[model samples]
Target: MMISNTPPPPYYAVIFTSVRTNDNEGYAETDALMSELALQQDGFLGMEHASSEIGITISYWRDVESIKHWKDNLDHQKAQIKGQKTWYSQYKVRIAKVERDYDFLKK
Candidate 1:
């Protein structure tokens, strides 16, 4: 996935790290659906994701309210339950405020 184009260094980021249980049932579809659904939310800024031995998905938000709104989404909540019960062997969620960021690209 490409890096997310965020406006500045004032947004919030929900960092999700996970290790899977090798149970792929319903995971890919639900993950894609959740990403699409997040884009439809009020203050979703952008997202970046990657997976390997350890997986990391960072979703950017406009503010704490936006993050909370996502946390309350019923579909996402259901996914969370399913993940706990079946998908992940272990996982962690971290929310942090962005204070500074920098990047560059070759022209």
Candidate 2:
């Protein structure tokens, strides 16, 4: 995926870092579904992710209330449960406010 074209400073980011378990059981489908569901949320701005032995996904949001709403979503909660019981060997979530951001592109 390309970089998310987020707005200027003052957005929230939910940073999800994860190491996977060996089980391939439906993980990819679940992941894709979550992405689709997140995009439909009220304040979802964008998302970016990469993975090797570990994975990191940062989902941008309009505000903390939006983040909370997403977290409380029933489907998302089910996915979280499944991740803990199946897909992820370990993971961490960090929420932060983006007060500043910059990027450079090559021509």
Candidate 3:
């Protein structure tokens, strides 16, 4: 997804940044599945993603508890293991609470 249609501020964002290994076997399918599964999670607001050599995905959440739940999800945990073993060379995750937000769109 591009810009995430999120709720008002004071929510949380989990920023996942990764650099892929040369091998991408099953990466696309796994990534798609993860996105779909994330949407099914409780308190999941939305997500934005982009990739080149480096990949970045930011998922919005209602609270820290929600974020923690996503992390501990069984399928997601499997994906994380797969990513570490096959897909990603390096990765980082950051969680932050949004205090305020504003956007301008041209119609």
- For each candidate, give its TM-score against the true structure: 0.97, 0.98, 0.96
As for candidate 3, its clashing pairs are none
Candidate 1 lDDT by residue in tens digits, 1-107? 78999988899999999999989999999999999999999999999998889999999999999899999999999999999999999999999999899999999
Cα-lDDT of candidate 2? 0.97
Query: In candidate 2, which residue pairs clash?
Result: none
| Per-residue lDDT over 13-35 for candidate 3, one digit per residue giving the tens place of the 0 to 100 score | 99999999998789899989999
Q: Pick the candidate with the highest lDDT.
A: 2
Q: Kindly state the number of residue pairs that clash in model 3.
A: 0
Model 2 backbone overlap count: 0
Supply candidate 2's per-residue lDDT for 86: 93
Please, what is the whole-model Cα lDDT of each candidate in the order they appear? 0.95, 0.97, 0.93
Model 1: residues with Cα > 4 Å off, grouped in runs: none
lDDT of 2 by residue, 27-88 (tens): 99999999999999999999999999899999999999999999999999999999999999
Candidate 1 residue pairs that clash: none
